[model samples]
Target: MHDDRHAPRKGAIPTHALKAAQEIVVLKWRRTSFKRLDGSIDVLDDDWSLSIGGRSLARIYLLNGGPQDGRWAWFVQVFPEGTPGNGGVGVDDDGRAAREACESLLPPAIQQALADGRKSETN
Candidate 1:
């Protein structure tokens, strides 16, 4: 919760943070066919990893069957070879929170690349 009386004037977590609304965050994630390290394409609706479009970005996953069902998971540099990743807590019933969580974990460069990719596609 943001303490309106003492929170920083320029930056603060909004009161609606708990709801995790799509409007609160501005990230565009398209469903792309995820290619495994073996180069096999697995295009499952529940598979949230959709190539963040950058150098060695993590592959974000939406948990469906595991104990952490409705949760999200990610790992850095999940391209050819990767690094350790992060996971989301609580349940994300609609995946909006997972998308927001994934966006938060993404590197700035990848996010920028995604923006740039959108621009080029429109041209």
Candidate 2:
């Protein structure tokens, strides 16, 4: 009796929030694996989201399942302001909205690094 939904089997990794923006969110999650009498397979699917002023900004879907060390994972899609083509709400007013969102999520060190990178690129 194996419950795939809530049960914690082997190779199951916990999901955690890593970064977020007004329209985007990044998350870190662990991969899961299962073994049966016939063979074994890996299951790696996770979801994340971002919010702004109590409103959801974006949704992130991740997939993490593969052979080898099992550390290989990938981000499947990043839905900003909900699903596209559905009249989704986004910060089209000014690019500042996006920049502010990014700043809020990123740490001071990372922000400085990004700023320096941008400066170097321009110079």
Candidate 3:
């Protein structure tokens, strides 16, 4: 992951410090494909804050899954408000894979928070 601790990375929006968020929402689920994938795990959590990291990562309402490479798959749209690449759909065999993939695309600071092993109330 790119380190931009001193400088704010473009499209990288920081949330209201995980320590301060209240009333956060957490969602987790999985989807299976009879065609190709066995299943995929997904986890999404976000605070009431409208900020990038504060909002839920899974945009299931906007998800549109289909075959991407001869294999049937579902895509969970994440970080809709972030820069084009900073946040986008994460494709995986299951929800967890998809969630981790999307989480990997988060801003550097958020990623660091995750690395630091901080637990939010939502978690």
Candidate 4:
């Protein structure tokens, strides 16, 4: 709804900020490899995924170019479906916000895990 929270990725589904069932939100993050212009693979530090129970739910990345270069972006996906468009673009600041913003789209376990002092470590 807000222009600042646009997902912008192709196949990104439009979602109305809903929290998924709590138990279904045991999320994890995994680093991703990117193919460089020279065809070399680079494991980026600013790009990673948001997973639930080891399955990918979305990706959080830093924009490489354009007016918003260096801004963090949220790329969400629903299994057997597509991605989320502008679901949580600029929810927070422009950097590292997706990591927090995307939480609203999923279960409350993320916060609960924190509250319980059991935050999942990045893998």
Number of the top candidate by lDDT? 4
lDDT of 4 by residue, 14-76 (tens): 232223323443434668776799999999887787654434566787877877777787855
Per-residue lDDT tens digits of candidate 3, residues 1-123? 987666634643344443322333332232221233656634333211113343443332223445543321233233433333325544455544555665566545445444444354335
Residue-level lDDT of model 1, residues 1-123, one tens digit each, is 656774433422232431232222333454547579999987777555544223223345577676877666554332111222332233455566655555555444445545565676678
Evaluate candidate 4 by giving its C-alpha RMSD to the native, one decimal. 9.4
Report, for all candidates in order, the number of backbone clashes: 0, 1, 9, 8
Off by over 4 Å in 4: 1-27, 34-42, 79-92, 109-123
Q: How does each model score on lDDT?
A: 0.46, 0.34, 0.39, 0.53
Could you tell me how far off, in angstroms, the CA of residue 63 lies in candidate 2 after the best superposition?
A: 24
- Every candidate's CA RMSD: 12.4, 16.1, 11.7, 9.4
Ranking by TM-score: 4, 1, 3, 2
TM-score between candidate 4 and the true structure: 0.49
List clashing residue pairs in candidate 2: 13-30
Query: Which residue pairs overlap in candidate 4's backbone?
Result: 6-86, 7-86, 11-83, 12-83, 12-84, 12-85, 13-83, 13-84
Model 3 stretches astray by more than 4 angstroms? 1-54, 57-86, 118-123
